[model samples]
Target: MDSAVSDAAVGVPPLAEPDEAPQPWQTDRTRAPVATKIVVAGGFGVGKTTLVTAVSEITPLQTEALMTEASEGTDDLTDTPDKTTTTVAMDYGRITLDDDLVLYVFGTPGQQRFWFMWDDLVRGAIGAVVLADTRRLKDCFPALDYFESCGLPYIVAVNHFEGSEQFDPEDVREALSIPAHIPVMIMDARRRISAIETLLALVAHALEETPEE
Candidate 1:
């Protein structure tokens, strides 16, 4: 579905027209930067690391270790034969959206064994980006359910991998049984601009879900 139509269906406020003057809060420079926490979660080898690295301004901290015989039977390498490393803990990065706003991104380990660390990683997160792989769409379900149970708003971003069959956002949404209000979009995790756009969408969705003071 088109973004405009999706936004309307999901109750996301439309972006202000370009000619409109900036809001007082937008123009304010005296306020201290607000730090927001965001989670980048998905299944194994679904590009969570790439997304975090692409958008972060600071050096990202990654805990990936080389794959070994220990995971021969447990880890699925059929879809990702070239994947030699696995995240043992989490990946962290930071992005400054503007002078007044910053985002702390935490990428969760894809393996179920490391999922125990997610509660701590997402302790104060405002929202999440659940990266989806068309080839392994079911892998994202756990993350999606976790965020929902925690009352954390999130947007699903389908990562486009070379040679993977392209699926429409609506089809993905239906296949995943995603609600109408949740956004589903396509993205290239390796590209900085693409990752930024996905992050912006999550931020926007989080803002909309936030109750006004």
Candidate 2:
């Protein structure tokens, strides 16, 4: 991830198009809005940390805690039995694009109870990137439902993990019951360019929903 960004900064080959600002409806500063918030969302262990840490301008504050065996029966530890640590509170960071443009990113905790906190986290958030792991595609349903119920625009980025079968975006959307308008993409969160592309898609999708004056 670091390599990708550093290379891009130095004018090395870039996989995506040259970085450009999102289409601006207005260019005035006094009437311009402040920074936007973007929530990085996904099922447990779907690479939220990796994506955030990769692109964040500052050191990320991760609230990860070592998981105890006592949580076995209580928490859903079905496929991820070896998972020892979990983020208890949240992960946060800021990304500054220019003097006036800043983006705040917040990563939600993994447990089901944390769902209650999402309402606050998503307030005024421009959009969310729903990370999906093909191995546990069903696990992302709760996040999807939450965003859909709130009418929060979002894009789903299918995370690629080792030994996971690659599925077409259409098939995955069919299985997840996602609307066609929502952007569905494939990405490796560990790569900076890949993660940035996901955010680009999210911002583009969100801007499209804004009623143009």
Candidate 3:
């Protein structure tokens, strides 16, 4: 007996054909948005999370852990004494620019022990924004070196904290020995407009450095 006939004879219904109909959730568009990945890196307590939160269109994903006595000497809180939580993993957020470009931002964990995660986080990233604090300028060196050694395009974003002495971008460049070609900007991480500008700067720099395929 034919399988279809046998099944019908057995009172079994034939299997339904796969759905060719468009899903209600699906939308048709002439062009898809361009998506890019970006990394926000800096030293411990340098406002990486704040920057991400400020610019993220959706609620940002955070992996912060409360500071404990165990981290006493290892974690320095001198400049950010009020900080009680530290990002143990990475911070994630998304933003859309120009209606056709989407940016997926990832903020690296600032603790030295979490440096291992940096390699994984930077995968597929177009470029990076290395956040710096004048109070602990040396802390950002690791991030800067990591990006440079890996040959990734990066720009420095000095996160100006309130009450901290502000320095000119050129002065910061000179102080950090950053190459003249690398753009550096002073921004407040807590402000949405400032963070957005920093992201725009990074996107522009990355585009300039990337070769057309």
lDDT per residue as tens, model 1, 116-169: 999999999889999999999999999998998999999999999999999999
Could you give me the TM-score of model 1 versus the true structure?
0.85
Evaluate residue 13 in candidate 3 and report its C-alpha lDDT on the 0 to 100 scale.
28
Root-mean-square deviation of every model: 7.6, 5.8, 15.9
lDDT of 3 at 212: 95
Candidate that would win on TM-score:
3
Off by over 4 Å in 1: 1-31
Error of 3 at 84 (Å): 0.4
TM-score of each: 0.85, 0.82, 0.86
Task: Give a tens-digit lDDT track for model 2, residues 1-213.
Answer: 477677477443333233554324235546553587899887888888878887676678898888887677766766666677887767886665544566678888756867778888788899999999888898889999989888889999999887779999988999998899999999988876677777778889999987789
lDDT for every model?
A: 0.87, 0.79, 0.87
Clash counts for all predictions = 0, 0, 0
Residue pairs in candidate 1 whose N, alpha carbon or C atoms collide under 3 angstroms: none
